[model samples]
Target chain A: MNVLLDNLSLFREGFIGTLELTGASALVAMVLGVIIAGFRVSPVPPLRIFGALWVTLLRNTPLTLLFLVAFFVVPKVLFPDLDSFLLAVCACGFYTSAFVAEAVRSGINTVPLGQAEAARSIGMTFTQTMSLVVLPQATRTVVPPLSSIFIALTKNTAIAGAFNNVDLFNVSKTLSNDGYDIAVIFLWITLAYLIVTYAINGLFRLLEHRLEVAR
Target chain B: MAEVSVTKDAAPAADELVALKNVNKHFGALHVLQDIDLTIAAGEVVVVIGPSGSGKSTLCRAINRLETVESGTITIDGKPLPQEGKELARLRADVGMVFQSFNLFAHKTVLENVMLGQVKVRKVEKAAAAQKARALLDRVGVGTQADKYPAQLSGGQQQRVAIARALAMDPKVMLFDEPTSALDPEMINEVLEVMQQLARDGMTMIVVTHEMGFARSAANRVVFMADGRIVEQATPDEFFNNPRSDRAKDFLSKILHH
Candidate 1:
């Protein structure tokens, strides 16, 4: 379409913005997910309660409400001059982290109890046992589910388009406002998302292969 | 559950490596261990034999404090079992445990499984750890399987690697909790042979097992337990040939006949 070539730079910025948003939020989600996963299994009661609350609250809350809180209320109440892009990142990243934590927890549970008992019997400290044995095995099982979560995250970035972030979805909105065919704009957005989603899937498959250990 | 001497006649003296006095444990409504008293002398091989759910495994597990006691004391080398944290871990390193399931760090290669505890807990150099691990694997006759993951090996080989892994730590005491129970009938003797060698070498060990032949041939003392109590403790000849309690006789006849 002539409209697409005329607005090539807008489309380029939109692609890059979607990548930036996904990358930044993915980093946030992964780091927070691991920490919250640790909390979910900690021996301390207060930490366990807090971890339970974190997953339940964020997972139960609708994404649109989170965006409203992140976009509309956060700047008014939390940070007056926060960029809407960062706010969108926060909303998406924080929301996805709850799912990430649950996936990590389930992965950990898949490791047999005897593994930890054996590690303990050998006199390995809890940290050594986790780092050496439990996490290594848990990591293998986690790859598939974590990849699914990340792919969901990549698609979920489209929601940020509504919050004034100029990502792939926003590019379609702008093109439509300028009288471009809606079908063509939507197809382009879908293709961009597929690229990102498939990229995540491929990366996780490689990771799964690397982490594979014979049962 | 009354307090009386369990293994008083056969009790060994000097250098008591492990001692449990009046240890009790419960699993919900079931009293698994009741007022237990057991001690292991240096180089003593005590084979614990009992029916299923007789608490032999629980008694062995309680040694390294894997199964916590409801009340009473367990001391290794005169120091009380560390309640938790680093001290307990350190003590566990000194007491090697071989389980029925082999528990051989499934993700690691056989060599790595043998070497990890040494390098991580004992802080041995990697080369030295590897050398020691290799030697122990050879000793247990699974040296060729070193590079393989646990699942790749047969049950017998996996159990042998497990023995080597435990032995690599140079433990003050080795606890065998039904180490060969999960093995095939042909594979069982291979694992038992390694344990026999350990007994011949005078490794301090407390073995919980169903293998009466092993108990008769290799045990310094055979402890007969039933109903969460140590019903008899005697030399293998005395206990196997002439079981004192009706319960042990019933158990021995059923086991020996079948």
Candidate 2:
């Protein structure tokens, strides 16, 4: 109890850091995923190849390797003065994006071919067909899979600790190093993660309920 | 209304509203359509009938280029169907297609499904499109279900909504690809009744169907196809009463009794 009381500020900062990483990474991954999924399904052969390669390459790489590569190369080449926090977000987002793309593509496939054909027959362009008919329907079907992606993303953000980004994992590690009750600190952080993940699951459950299509 | 002529050759007459010349299509090793040469005049109703896999649906789809032909020409109102880009879209706006699946946008309300093409394709004002869609819905006897999604309606009601959606575009010609095939026996009559009314109003239509009753009562001419070829095409009386080809006679024998 005294250990937690002594490090309340550290725990607060760590929780905030975790939230920022998870939230920002999730947003970036979702946008990138949609674009990648679009490329995978596009009529253009080159874009489909690019999408295929991107998912294959990124999804196969471990998150830790991505963070090391991003930290080592991205800062020097892309943003010399970039904060380690933002770099971690980028690494996490890029890695998770491949999963997001696959999930969204599966969602798109769930829509019947007749739906798109009907839109096209009525003079809707490919873009119009996707936005107005296919994607709207796909969105509903994608919720559960997308929620799983984000849930995995939340847990994976702990990899930022390797780069010394003071997230939940690092905070608990610091407490252990300082001769605090390691088991208690681990339990508290584990509970914290459970709270966060369950909250995310609940939010998605609400969304799925609201968007459920009537049969 | 003007008197209409049907062309039998590659070059259509000046009066032909929809024309196909030697249209051939293949899906992998399967030749879905072969040497399809047909012509329909403005406001003519032609019913195409055949056994399953005889390319009836493919022929109807090729008119709007929903199914592209491997080698042939399809012209609507003297203009060749554009292969792609904005021209194809504009051409599609002139030809409305209804599918066997009722293919109504499941996420949209019945009225919105009808209004979408009018507003998007024809650039009709939203208010005017809505009003027109309401009238079409009423005509199809599903005006009360206008606010409901497609899944909320019966198969017959959904098919009627699909018809309304096509008519809302004010197309020069309407193509029906087995529109009643997906409906239950009792439900089929409701959709056929709506189609019969459209024919009476002199809407140009090319229907692919097995409903002998519709062919007898509504179609100006009946075209019988077998194995990717049109075996016979004649006025309903001639086609039904005295089919020239043995294939047509055999097809009629099976479907008419069933």
Candidate 3:
């Protein structure tokens, strides 16, 4: 506990770093996930195939492997001199997007087929039916699964600590080397993650509550 | 009228609103609609009736191309059903469909459900759409339930709202696919009365239903289908009292007794 007080700035930087990483990646994941999910349900076969292929590659790979690839491979193969932090963000964000895409696709499926048909019968085009009728209804079932995926994403950001990102996991290592109790360091890290996860849950619960139509 | 090719786009008579010719469709091994031919003049009320799996409902759905056929043409207002895109949507705006399950937009208020198609498809101003929606809801007798979600309403109320939603488009023809079949017995007539009133007002309607009393009273022509074919087509009195086909006789005997 005394060690924690002594190293307050380290904990603060780590806490802020974790939040920044999560926020940036969550944004990336949501945008990519929605686009991928759109591809998954698209009437075009090529788009559907592309969506499936992306999810398979990202979702099946280990998070550690993706971090390594983002750090080592992307800068060499894709962009020269890209910051390592941005690389790790892309890794965590795109990886979680696969899970997010699945959640969104399943949510779209939960909407009864008749809802789309009904929209069509009344003269709505495919896009109109989806945006106006299907997606709004699908969103009700989507929020819960999306919350789980995002919470998992927050915890998954810890993987960045290993790749020189200076996130919470890295802070634990730095403090432990300076003779802080490992258990106490781990305990605080766990508490920080719990706060983030609970905040994610609260946000999604509020969205879900607001989305529910009367009755 | 000559045997009009689907490609001709030649306006059939000014009165002909819908025409399905040589339509054939199969669901895997079963041919659900076989070489079907039917037409409805403007303001004519056609009632389609048959036992389960007899293809009456399939026939009703094909007009709007909700259930597309394998090799045939369905013309609405003398034009072929557009394969896809905005043209098809425009064609559908003139054709209102009511489903057995009501299929109201469950997340929307009854008023929103009615306003949606008008605003999105018809491109009506929101204020105009809302006003028309209120009138339609009032017409269907669910005016008070305008702000309520579909889940909050009873089955009958939901069904009426569905009717109002379709009617909001000012469709040239209304297709009712077992509108009363999913309702409670006590609530069936409320919906049927709405249909009866629509028929009396000379709205072109094609209803697929088991309610024979409605057929006897409202249908100008009763089409009896069986095994994916039109077994009998005649005036209501002639079809109900003197069913020509043995299939129609058997179907009537089984259903009309109780």
| lDDT per model vs. reference | 0.88, 0.89, 0.88
> Chain B TM per candidate, please?
0.96, 0.94, 0.94
For residues B180-206, could you state the per-residue lDDT of candidate 1 as single tens digits?
A: 899999999999999999999989989
- Report the CAPRI category for model 3: medium
Which candidate leads the pack in lDDT? 2
* Clashing residue pairs, backbone N/CA/C < 3 A, model 1: none
Q: Please, what are the lDDT tens digits per residue for candidate 2 over residues B1-258? A: 111223333222567899999899999999988888888988788999999999999999999998889999999999999865578888898888999999999889999999988887788999999999999999999999999989999999999999999888889999999999999999999999999999999899999998989999998888888888887878888788888787888878887775
> What are the TM-scores, per candidate, against the unseen true structure?
0.91, 0.91, 0.91
Model 3 residue B228 lDDT score: 92
The superposed Cα distance between candidate 2 and the true structure at residue B194, in angstroms, equals 1.6
DockQ of each: 0.70, 0.62, 0.75
The weakest ten consecutive residues by lDDT in model 1 chain B span B2-11
lDDT of 3 by residue, A1-215 (tens): 77668888988889888898899998999889978988898766898999999999999999999998888888889898888679888999999899989988898999999999899999998789888988877887888999999899889989898888888898999999888899999998899889889999999998988886433
Per-residue lDDT of candidate 3, residues B178-228 (tens digit): 999999999999999999999999899999999999999998888888889
True contacts kept of each: 0.88, 0.72, 0.79
Q: A87-177, model 1: which lDDT tens digit per residue?
A: 8889989999999999988988999988988999999876777778887789877889999888888888888987899999889999999
lDDT of 3 at B153: 92
lDDT of 2 by residue, A1-215 (tens): 78778999999888887888899999999999998998898766898999999999899999988998899987778878888888998999999999999999999999999998999888887777778888888998899999999999999999997686988988988899999988899988898788889999999999998887343
Clashing pairs in 2: none
